[model samples]
Target: MDRKKAAILALSLLTIISTDTVAPLVKQISASYPQVSSTMVKLTITLPSLLMIFFGLIAGQLVKVISKKAILAIGLVLYSIGGIAAGWSESFPGHLILRGLVGAGTGLISPIITSLIADYYQGKERADMVGYTFAISHFAAVITPPLAAYLGAEDWRKAFIIFSIVPLVFLFTMIFLPGTARRVQSDAAEKRKAPIPTKAIQFALIALVMMIIFFIVITDLPYLIETKTGISPIVSAFGLSTCTLGATIAGLTFSQIYVRLKKWAIPTSLLACGLGFLLITFSGTSVLILGGLLCIGMGIGILISLIMLVTANSAGEADSTAAVALVNGGFSIGIFISPFFYANLPRIELGLPAVEFNFLLAGVLFAAAGVIALLVAISTNKQLNLPHR
Candidate 1:
């Protein structure tokens, strides 16, 4: 691979490094911040997603004014700063501030990556690269979660602090690499060349809806399972690890399937995701929950791979980065809203209360994503005239 491809490859590691520190250190963070409620701590976890919501869109415009390479470099540096600052946060507000900055870093990298890939390659090669990129993300996912748990056991501070080094890796790779996205001639030239497609807009909406449901399930369901089923931390982490395994397998496989039928990707993934949620809502035992997670993770894997694929196809060259940024915004929105839904769910078995409604609410969103997917299907088949279903 060339220098630009090398930089693109490094983007996968950034995802792993960013979230790996959070889960294992949750207990320590809860204990350290005496003034913060568990719910408030959840907010801190959701903070990046919240920032992603706005920044994904803002990042698109930002790329217009500055080089994508510069945005990524600055974002990664800030991300390190946020991670280091949060490691020593003495107050809830301080942690929140650091998390918001970390979110900014996240907002910059992923979309820039997708856009960069679109800029660099085309035809079958583009499809293959995107698939491999997603596979790397899953590989990182598998390693990061467990390693985080181990490191947190030894020293949680090191967990967050260690990730600060990842940006250095991304920055180094980017510096050594050549820029892939060529500068357009005039201010209006790039926009005219890469005008937003109707398909891209619809793809983004579907991406947003699917992510909203995925985060809702992942964020709220784990705690519910722990408290309701009396599962130990090790067991809980292992089970969630299974989700990563499923996601990994699917990420690699879907890239091939998507290449054969580019237009149908979003709707197909959405239907699968909706079914996964139904499985989760009704899942009563630990085994059932694990199965549901597997299905859900598989769906998510497919969705991520396809969304980027669709973005590349629809966006003009210059605007492609912005389109990817918009998809990132959708991702952030999902995380941001999952908690809001998580909070409102009826409490589980409070001695006086009935069964928990968290998964049930999550089920509704998952199923709703399916509805959105079907609508997208109708619009796609009719507007694009490609028989998306």
Candidate 2:
């Protein structure tokens, strides 16, 4: 890959990894924020993207006036700072604001990466990068929880400190990145901008909905394993790790999977995930729930990889940053809304330290998103009428 393309992939993966690294520290964070409710704590983790949804396009639109590399670097800086702040914060509101800053940085970096990658790579390479990015992100997801546990045990602050350093790694990547991919203020780019691909936007929306399912499985299901079934925190984290591990494997070959199956992959994976969720909801056995979670995790790996593939291809540009943004934006938005599903679940019983509902309603969302993904594919494929030859 070209330097610019490599930078885009590296930067995008960094943002993805950084966002989830805090998961293991949420409990520690809540302990310090004595006045913050659980909902607020959840927001501390989730609300940053609410800001991101509004401004994801701003950094890229400023491409003519600013360097894409600079914007990405700045975003990484914000992410690292916010992470550090979360670790150090004593007040609920302060952590909330810093997390938003972190989200903004994540929001800013992805579109530029999308735009740069589409601009620099093409066809299978572009698709492959999308999958690889997912794989790397999943790799982060796998490492972060265990790492966070170690760091948090040492000092919850260390978890955030660990992420503060991750962004610095990308600075070297920026140095190696080529700079030709900037929008360059050409009249041609301006004109072509008017007819943004509808299918790309469609894929983006699909990402948002599909990801509701992903989060439901990842974020919500573990609570169910812990509260509903009484699994220990350490065991729960390991079980959740199953999802990340699956994502890593699936993403490594996402382009090939996309070419072989296209949109069909989403529904197929969802079906598997849905079955797992159902099994967990009813079963008390740790082994059974773990197996179900494994299926859910592996299926989601395939599902999300497919979503990224569809978005990248639908845009039809090697440097289609907007396309990537659209999907990421959808993803961010889905994350923001996912907490509602957990509202109806069971609670930590009297004198018992635990969470309620096991995020069962969240599973309902996963099942629903799966159904919608299938419908979207069937309907849009017919509408687009892609080439028969």
Number of backbone collisions per candidate, in order?
1, 11
lDDT of 2 by residue, 255-308 (tens): 676667665776767777777777677677777777776777677777776666
Which tens-of-lDDT digit does each residue in 100-209 have in candidate 1? Answer: 88888877777777777776777667777777788777767666666666767766666675675665776676686565375354666547456556777777676666
State the local distance difference test value for candidate 1: 0.67
The lowest-lDDT stretch of 10 consecutive residues in candidate 1 is: 380-389
lDDT accuracy of residue 1 in candidate 2: 53
Clashes of 2: 11
TM-score of each: 0.83, 0.84
Error in Å for residue 140 of model 2? 1.0
Reference-based lDDT, residue 23, model 1: 56
